[model samples]
Target: MTRTVLAIDIGGTKIAAGLVDEAGTVLAEAVVPTPTGDAEQTWQAVADCARQVLGDTSVEAIGACCAGPVDIGAGTVSPINITCWREFPLRARLRELATGATVELAGDGVCMALGEHWLGAGQGSEFMLGMVVSTGVGGGLVLGGRPYPGRTGNAGHIGHVIVEDDGWPCTCGGRGCVETVASGPNMVRWARTQGWQAPDHADAAHLAAAANHGDKIALATFQRGGRAVGMAIAATAVVCDLELAVIGGGVSKAGDLLFDPVREALADHARLSYVDQLRIAPAALAKNAGMIGAAAMALRADI
Candidate 1:
């Protein structure tokens, strides 16, 4: 019989759940807006979504991906963006919801990398990094064709990697991190600071639209963010000897406005031949990468 796993992705803004087969096919899925009230409310939303998606389906295992930092051993998570979830016992709760199946948890970035490695942009690469550049930045790595969650399950946190010695403060209690320079909100803020007039509900998409329309300030904003991301990728490539880097999340939808400068900056910063050969590409599976990755984790315990 074919094996199936329950896959769940938890983010600050939304919660998603799905039933995935061993072949990376999503049999069924559901999404719900994340509640901002409290931890229990958020947990309820996740549980409800999972229950709705699963219905009467039976799965062999359950896999969950959430924002970090995660304690894989303790089966807990403390996502920075979700304020109420400091040291939340996510794995236990998921296990409770799923009843008899095995439940596993990892950082969202790791799941993304594993998902891409199994079925997306990083499919053929032996070593790869996956990054999410949305409200916050996160990353994961795949080495030797397996997801590497590191000791604390927070290995590929490239966003928190200090890129600027004296840059903006991060929620993670750090300064000048890549997130300060490259996240969607920060990029939009930088553009506004440079006198870019934006609509009342301005965001990265709005900024991208302006950039596409030849707005110098908006264009400069993307370039600045892209360079920061490129620098992070270069550093990671040098350290991890990554063969490919796959980028996803909301801001990555900006197309050439983000990628062109990222590649240019990579060329300028990565002097070593090995690092220079690193290829970066947009995520192939788009929004489903996390769920698929989560399923990969559940199905392959070795990962």
Candidate 2:
């Protein structure tokens, strides 16, 4: 009999829950808009989604992939972007929902990386960084075959890594963080400042498409984001010396518009021999990454 795990992914915009099997198959899934400005409301939304998915199946365990900076060992998180969850106890709440089965919590970025390491692009690489570039940028890593949850479970939070010492202020109370210049919304904001009057994020995509089709302003925005990513990745490579970097999330859809420049920037900045050889690739798992990653976290524990 195949074992099933209930997995949940909570983000700034939505909450996704699913029943996943040991084989990494998402048997059933559902999504609901995240609660606005209320942590209890958001937790309730997550529980409701999980209950709905669990109505027809018996899961042996539960795993959650959520926005961080979370204390993985402590099972707590304070997603800076989500104000209502200032130091919320996610692990305890998840346990309450699990009813009896064991449940685990991890940074969504780490889960994404775990998912990739287990079944996607990072399958063969032991040292890798799994990145999600969306409304905000975030990541997780598997170093020495184990998830390295930094001193406070906020490891792999590449988003807040300062790229510009004097750039835009970040939600994390820092200026010139990578996410400030590289996230989807930030890219759109940057484009607007460049005289590209895009009304929202879709316009930013259009701008990228335009750049791909030879629009100068849009091309510049991608270059700016790419440069920030490159600088950040270069810094990480110097520190982690990882074998590969896998990027995912909705904004990754920009594809060449985002990566080509990152590669260029990385090449320009990576002075060390090993750093120069690092491979950065788009994430292969896409939407299912979190569920697979959360499940992988549990399975890896048994090994």
lDDT of 1 at 183: 97
* Candidate 2 backbone collisions, by pair: none
RMSD of each: 1.0, 1.5
lDDT of 2 by residue, 1-303 (tens): 777888999888888998887788888989998888588988899899989898967666888888887887777888876779987999889887666778778888888888988889898887888888888999988888677667776788899889989999989888999999999888888888888865554545676777878878888998999889888888887899887889887778889988998899888988798777889999999988877888876655652
Q: Write the per-residue lDDT of candidate 1 for residues 1-303, one digit (tens) a residue.
A: 889889999998889999898889999999999899899999999999999988988776999999988999999999998999999999889887767889889999999888988999998898999999999999999999889999999999999988899999999999999999999999988888899998868999999999999999999999999999999999999999988999999999998899998999899888798787889999998899889999998897666
In model 1, the worst 10-residue window by lDDT is 95-104
Per-model lDDT: 0.92, 0.84
Best by lDDT: 1
Off by over 4 Å in 1: none
Q: Least lDDT summed over 10 consecutive residues: which range in candidate 2?
A: 197-206
